[model samples]
Each structure stands twice: as structure tokens, then as C-alpha cells.
Target: MRVIFAGGGTGGHLYPALAVAEELSSRDPGFEALFVGTSRGIESRVVPASGYGLELISSRGARGKGAAGKAVTGAMLAAGTFQAMGIIRRFKPDLVFGSGGYASVAAVCAGWLMRKTVVLQEQNSVPGLANRTLAPMARRLYLGFEKARGYFRRGAPVVVTGNPLRGAIKPGPDRDARKDFGLSGDGPVLLVFGGSQGAMTLSRAAAGYLLRRTDVQAII
Candidate 1:
């Protein structure tokens, strides 16, 4: 089966698609996958590195924009949708999967317009604007958090499937994992990360906590 996976801008929006593609490839050697995203998105680098074909579309975030900016964003989204439609036509994917981001808007919209099977995967507790707007077009909506269900339409096809993890991520021996981080002690170790795109708030909070508790070794 051929699938078109669309989403990017951050690892949070991109990695889940990669994980699903990896799993499908593992199960069916003949399965083919293509990724659609903006050139500026993380998918530009991540998708090719993961050994998948990637098609770039024009897109920009409309959030935090003024009237003029929103107009420009709308133009870009229209261009992106046109480009995505071309890609979809040429690729003829059996399914189009959307993870949530500005990059997903065009491809998902194109898929819906073409009457293709469209699916969405939302990774946050609060659904993003793109996913919320495209939810009705999706054949199925996979959510990372159960609480996210309430945000969608009452009868929407929402399924609480936790975020997909990459095949490369696997738990190893505790000592080995600690050693990799240069921590040899048996003391408690803390892992702090602000998702794929680092958050200033999380960084500041973690710093304050670490300062108060020097006993805890953290990998940020």
C-alpha cells in the first residue's frame, strides 16, 4: 500500500509519522510511503534521513498574525494545497495521514478534496488548529491523550492511541543508559526535555528545580 504522511515544523509532529511508516514497512516490505511538508519544517531533514521520499509544499503559520499576515498565510496555504494536490495525483497514495502542524494543513486538505482516505494523529492533550479544522475530513482520528477526545465533535471518530515512538527508541540497562550520559552514581537521575521544539518556560523551570536540588542529576 502507498501512504502519504504529512506533518512537520517540529519533531513532535514529524516523528510519529516516521514511527508509523517504519512499523508498516517492517510488517509489509512492499509498503511505500511518501512525506509531505514544508521546506522549512523539520521534515525536510528528518524524512530523507529516515530513508523516505519527501515532497515540500508552501506553508506558513497563521497564528499570532495580524490581518495582513493572515492574508499572506492564506495565500501560502492555497499554494501549498495546489502543490499537495499535484503530489497526491502523481503518487496516487492509498491513504493520507496527517499529524498536526501548519505543514499538515495543505496536504490533508488536498487529500480530502480529492476524496482520498485521510487520517489524522493528534499528539497533544489540546488539539491544534489544523487538526481541529480537518477533523471532520479524516476517516479516523488517533489521539495521544484521552482528554483530547472532548475537544473534537461529539460523534467524531476519535481513538486514543498514545503517541507513536520511533523504533530506535528502546530501553536499555539502567547502568548503560546512565553511563551514556556520563553519570556513574546510583543517585536519582532526571530527564527533562521540552518536546521536539525546546520551550523556554520548561527550561527555566527545570533550571530552578535543579538549583534547589543539586542531588538530582538531570539530562536536559
Candidate 2:
């Protein structure tokens, strides 16, 4: 089967699509996958390295921008929709999967316009704007958090898939994990991270926690 996985901007959006692509390849050797993302997104680097065909399209975030900025982004997105349509026509994907992100917006919209079967995966407690916008067009909506389903319209089948995570995230041997962090493995281990670029708020909070608790071992 041929598939197109669309999403990017951060690891939170990209990695889940990668995980799904990896699983599809593992399950079916004949499965082929293509990833569509913006040239500026992390997917530009991550997707090709994972051995999937990567298609770069222009995209921009609409949040926290002025009217002129929004207009520019809107034009970019329209151009990206055409690019995505061309890619879809050439790839002839059997399925199009969208992980919620600004980068996925055009691709998903293109898939819908082409009358292709589009699926969505939302990775946060709150559904992202892209996913909400495309939900009506999606054949199925897969959610990382159960609470997210309430945000969508009530027609599509929603499944709580608990986020398709990479194999590297499995429960590690605490002793080994601690040793990797240069800790003695005698206390609790805290794993702190803010999405892909790292959140300053989370960093500050983690720093404060670490400062107060000398007994804890953390990997940040």
C-alpha cells in the first residue's frame, strides 16, 4: 500500500507519523510511505533520514501573527495545497494520514479535495486547529488523549490510540537509565522535556524542582 503521512513543525507532530510509517513498513514489506511537510519544519531533516520519501511544500503558522502576516501565510498555504495535490497525484496514495500541525494543513486539505481517504491523529489533550479544521473530512480520527475527542464534531469515528510512540521510548531499566544520566540509581528518576525545541516554562520548572530535590535523578 502507498501512504502519505503529513505533519511537522515539532517532534510531537513528526515523530508520531514516523512511528506509524515504521510500523506500516514492518507489518507489510510492500508498504510504501511518503511524508509531506514544510521546508522549514523539522520533517525536512527527520523524514528523509528515516528512509521515507519527503516532499517539501511551503507552509506557515497562522497563530500569533498580524493581519498582513496572516494574509501572507494564507497565500503560502494555498500554494502548498496545489503542491500537495501534485504530490498526491503522482504518489497515488491509498491513504493519507494527518498528524496535527500547521505543516499538515495544506496536505490534508488537498487529500480531502482529491476525494482520498484521509485519517487524522491528534497528539495533545486539546486538539490542534489543523486537526479540528480537517476533522469533517477525515475518515477516522485517532487521538492520543481521550479527552480530545470532545472537541471534534460528532460524526467521524474517534479512536483513542494513545499516540504511536517510537520504539526508543519504552520503559527502560531504571539502573541503566540512571547510569546513563550519571546518577547512582538510588532515587526517583525524572524525565523532563518540552516538545522538540524545549519549553522555557518546563525548563524553568524542572530546574526549580531539581534544585529543591537533590535526591532525584533527572534526564532533561
Error of 2 at 169 (Å): 3.8
Residues 1-220 of candidate 2 have per-residue lDDT tens digits of 9999999998889999999988888899899999999888899998888888999998988955688888898999999999999999999999999998999999999999999999999998888889999899888999999899899877668999898978767897777867777888477878887754338888889999899998887888
Candidate 2 steric clashes = 0
Candidate 2 has an lDDT of 0.90
lDDT of 1 by residue, 1-220 (tens): 9999999998889999999999999999789999999889999998999999999999998855588888899999999999999999999999999998999999999999999999999999989899999999999999999999999989999899999998899989898888889996678998887854447788889999999997899998
What stretches of model 2 exceed 4 Å from their correct place? Answer: 63-65, 195-198, 210-214
Clashing pairs in 2: none
Question: Poorest 10 consecutive residues of model 2 by lDDT?
Answer: 189-198
Cα RMSD to the true fold for all candidates: 1.7, 2.0
User: How does each model score on TM-score?
Assistant: 0.93, 0.91
Error of 1 at 220 (Å): 2.0
Candidate 1: which stretches are off by over 4 Å? 195-198
